[model samples]
Target: MQKNLLFYEKVNKRFILFLALVCFSGVLFAQNKTITGKVVTNESDSSLEGVTVKVKGSATSTMTGKDGSFSISAPANATLVISSVGFLSQEVAVKNQSNIIVKLATDQQSLQQVVVVGYGTVKRKDVTGAISSVTAAQIAKVPVTTLDQALQGRAAGVQVINNDAS
Candidate 1:
């Protein structure tokens, strides 16, 4: 009889421990809150999709949906960072916020800036020399591996010919 009682006591202890673990998991899941928001361009008032939305100081993040909307679950006091290419990054405090709308300002000055020439860099407003700007799309259209190879036949006044003789 004593051996049976000891076995029953061990089983009861394990059952209690399992119950406590389930309760703790429920509490943890309940503490997290969902945050949602939309990201738009400040200049054009257009929705910006696929933007990266991250929680500050945490490894949690999400990308904007097709309509520039995003949803993330985090603690109430977490802060969020919204970032995209060619736009100014924004940081938002998420205290007591269930929903938010962010308007990202375009870094127009970065797009309109001039390139460096010869020995010095000059802005587009102050440059008097002839300059040409090539975008990433233009560079991707060519099938060359090197800069010298891609520049061949693309520029009007530039010529590049490979010499094979040593």
Candidate 2:
């Protein structure tokens, strides 16, 4: 009877150890894989720079280098989303593949809608600031000493205050 109890104890210990190994093996094998890819223009096949690459369902992301090459870690079956300015975004499946190449078509609407402003450029549809023009006639009508005073009423939201008490 004692021998049977000892055998059962050994069996229980071995069973627990086996279960632990199985759980750990599944986790180790399910880890994220490294994926590499390149982004290029559909028309020219020129490598694009500063393209954004991201894992579809997670925050993992990277940017393409000057050569349009990128590397990121994601699940083996995960999807990758690529995006850039003036180009349509794309998605690729990472299923048992380690390398990929994505061609992005130019968005004519986006290209035509960009407005070059004072310092930078932005989409025309996204411009929300009021652009009030001060005409030369308006500036001539204002008998002011400086240009700031001339824009007092001709321009919208213009405020000129003289800080001199004299």
Candidate 3:
């Protein structure tokens, strides 16, 4: 009878030890992972500087370096959201991957944020008078042989006809 009681106590002690080990292992494995990536433009394949890289559903975020490289710490199942001015945003899944490459396309919508009227700049909403704006980026898209040609079709109600003054 005494032997039976001793056996029962030993079994209970082993079970409790096993439960404690399982709990400790769970706590150890629940840790964050370090993720690294690079950001570039899809059109030009150039490094994008000062890009904002954020962990989705969390406040953890970091900015890219001058070489478009970034490093952050997050959970394995977390998602990363990358964004910058003049470029479209991108979201990538960690999925236990350590290194990633992200390409961002240019966003035309950001170009409409400001308007150049005459010699000064103004926000898009504050303009109440007739204003014609031309952005340097828009001019770069077209092949203009002269200054007159660059302004062609850029502003509303404005016409640029080459008079052959040369």
Q: What's the CA RMSD of model 3 in angstroms?
A: 13.0
Write the residue-wise lDDT of candidate 2 on 1-166 in tens digits.
Answer: 9999999999999999999999899889877889998999999999999999999989999999999999999998899999987789999998978999999998888666656566698775466665455667879987889876776777567676766767
For all predictions, the C-alpha RMSD in Å is 9.9, 9.0, 13.0
Which candidate order results from sorting by TM-score in descending order? 2, 1, 3
TM-score of 1: 0.57
Against the reference, the lDDT scores of all candidates come to 0.84, 0.86, 0.88
Better of 1 and 2 by lDDT: 2
Cα deviation of 20 in candidate 1 (Å)? 4.4
Tens digits of per-residue lDDT for model 3, 52-124? 9999999999999999999999998999999976678899998999998999998877646887665698866
After superposition, the stretches of candidate 3 with alpha carbons farther than 4 Å from their true spots are 1-29, 116-118, 121-166
Q: Which candidate comes out best when scored by TM-score?
A: 2
Q: Which lDDT value does model 1 have at 52?
A: 98
C-alpha RMSD between model 1 and the true structure: 9.9
Error of 3 at 105 (Å): 0.6
Residue pairs in collision within model 2: none
Q: List the residue pairs that clash in candidate 3.
A: none
